[model samples]
Target: MSDPATSPERHPDAHLIQQAEVPPLDVDGVQAASVGTGVFAVATVIMAVGYDTLAAAGDGWWLGVGISGFGLGLISLVYTNDRRRRRRRGEKLSA
Candidate 1:
């Protein structure tokens, strides 16, 4: 029987498998927010210009969908930013 740590064949490149500690970035969050804002702006325009056409469903269904999508995107953007901030501060990212 041979010791695993002393055998080169058992643990080759052990130093290369180490994990690095780094903070998360906000590029993705910013991009998501930009896209969300664009969607919201376009939806607002549609609602203003074609309210009558879109209100065919007794109400403005498309408007609601657009607004919801925009809201979700914004939420995602904010959540991502918060995660990045927490990561920078060495906080645990569980949620």
Candidate 2:
């Protein structure tokens, strides 16, 4: 009454299929963004005090750029963590 082709034991490789573990989005993005923010902060301080100090008087344009970079990194980190939280709750992303 049993067909060999339809039997699971007939195919030993059937149970061997394994799924790879996926990395969490928040962990990946947050780490990178935090590092970026720290780097930008350090660079901003160095630029504000080190280079062309007499001319810019700590108001250099590069300081603004570095601050912007830090802000953007923090925003991205927050977004990434929020996405991870939503995913854990099994909520779908809205358009």
Top candidate when judged by lDDT against the true structure: 2
Candidate 1 weakest lDDT stretch, 10 residues: 10-19
In candidate 1, which residue pairs clash? none
Give candidate 2 regions above 4 Å deviation: 1-28, 51-59
Tens digits of per-residue lDDT for model 2, 1-95? 88766886777556545689997764436677778879988987887676687355755677778779878888987987887688788899785
- Following a full C-alpha superposition, what root-mean-square deviation does model 1 have from the true structure? 7.6
Estimate, for each residue in 1-95, the C-alpha lDDT of model 1 and write its tens digit: 88767876866657536678988764437666767778786977778688897687577777777778778777777877777688788897674
Q: For each candidate, what is the lDDT?
A: 0.74, 0.75
lDDT of 2: 0.75
